[model samples]
Target: MKNINSKKLLPINMNSIIEGHMVIIKPISKKEINKTYLSWLNDSQINKYLEVRHNKQTINGIFDYVNSHRSRENSEVFAIFTKKGIHIGNIGVIYDKDNKYVEYGIMIGNKKAQMLGLGGEATILMFEFLFKNKGFRKIFNGVISKNESSWKLFESIGSTREGILRGQCICSSKKPCDVYLYGILRKEWLNSRKKYLNILKNIKIKNG
Candidate 1:
């Protein structure tokens, strides 16, 4: 994997508490992707809700996608690991120049890590980095309506429902699905720090 310039890597406020847990968000590394990671891509349970097709993710394909995105301007992808060094998932933010908006996405591939608020913690950290360090004005995300867990995760972190895109996404099932758009502004995020901090606190307690 390509190395991210520490200078260019935005710094987030490590002190923000989410669910009473102190989660750390850091840059991804090649070590995070191994044979086990490839197996994750092949896992039907994990790929069911993702946009990418599992059959398309060859070893080279994974490396190329990660390296290319890492080198892109206004885009960042971080491997979500706990301070204890457990790999939970990955999260990314993409800034659209044409719309002047940033969009974010994440996945918790580890079944053991699901529903534990780790995704929310990682997202909060990334959102702070985008708004404070990158000077992004707004951030948005689209979650399939069927993915209630993901929708709840976004809302728990202060994003508001923007609108619904009917028949917007076609999953591997080949059926059209409604995509729910959610977004948060810099001002809205600033106001949500307290709630996020509380969530972080809880996460720390649970992890401990």
Candidate 2:
């Protein structure tokens, strides 16, 4: 991975906070790492699609991972919070400065947060921050083909099905699965932002 030159990035608050109607994204802190967070990583149901599921998770290791992201110039991780300030999940991005693109992964660790469209809200907020604020040209997301909900979340937000790598990943099923690649160019996101925004709004209404 290319190291991001801090000077090359546009000036933005290190403590940047992105707010949506249902969820918020902000830099995660040590205080947010707790028993519940640890449980999420260890839970088979929650981490089934996560690469981290291959290894055991420990409190110390999770803390170390978060700290590493803090110090890494090319990447950052943020806690996904609800409007009520509940820390339900996490989202992270790694920048490829030379290519002017970003790739991200997210987890809605809290079961209560799943299937409610909050993930989509959180994703859109992140995309808005990356494309509009950070000036990234494209955003890329990859999901195990079995994780239909995940890829569909990206699609609902206007991402295109770019490509697939057959049997690229070993999943929790103990078998290999295809990795579905999805992406959205900055121009495409800009053009369809409003339409998807309304779709998400209606989801909130229906689920509310």
lDDT value for candidate 1? 0.69
TM-scores for all candidates: the values are: 0.79, 0.86
- Which whole-number lDDT from 0 to 100 does residue 17 have in model 1? 25
RMSD of 1: 5.8
Segments of candidate 1 deviating more than 4 angstroms: 1-22, 199-208
Expressed as tens digits, the lDDT of each residue in 1-208 for candidate 2 is 2333322322222457777778878877766778899999999999999988999887777766665555545567789888899999998787776787888899999999899988888887788778777778999989999999999888887899999999998999899999999999999989868876654452321110
Per-model C-alpha lDDT, please?
A: 0.69, 0.79
Q: Write the per-residue lDDT of candidate 1 for residues 58-129, one digit (tens) a residue.
A: 666566556556565666566777667777787766667787788788888878888877777677767766
Please state the error at residue 56 of candidate 1 in Å.
3.5
Error of 1 at 194 (Å): 2.6
Q: Who wins the lDDT comparison?
A: 2
* lDDT for 31 (candidate 1): 70
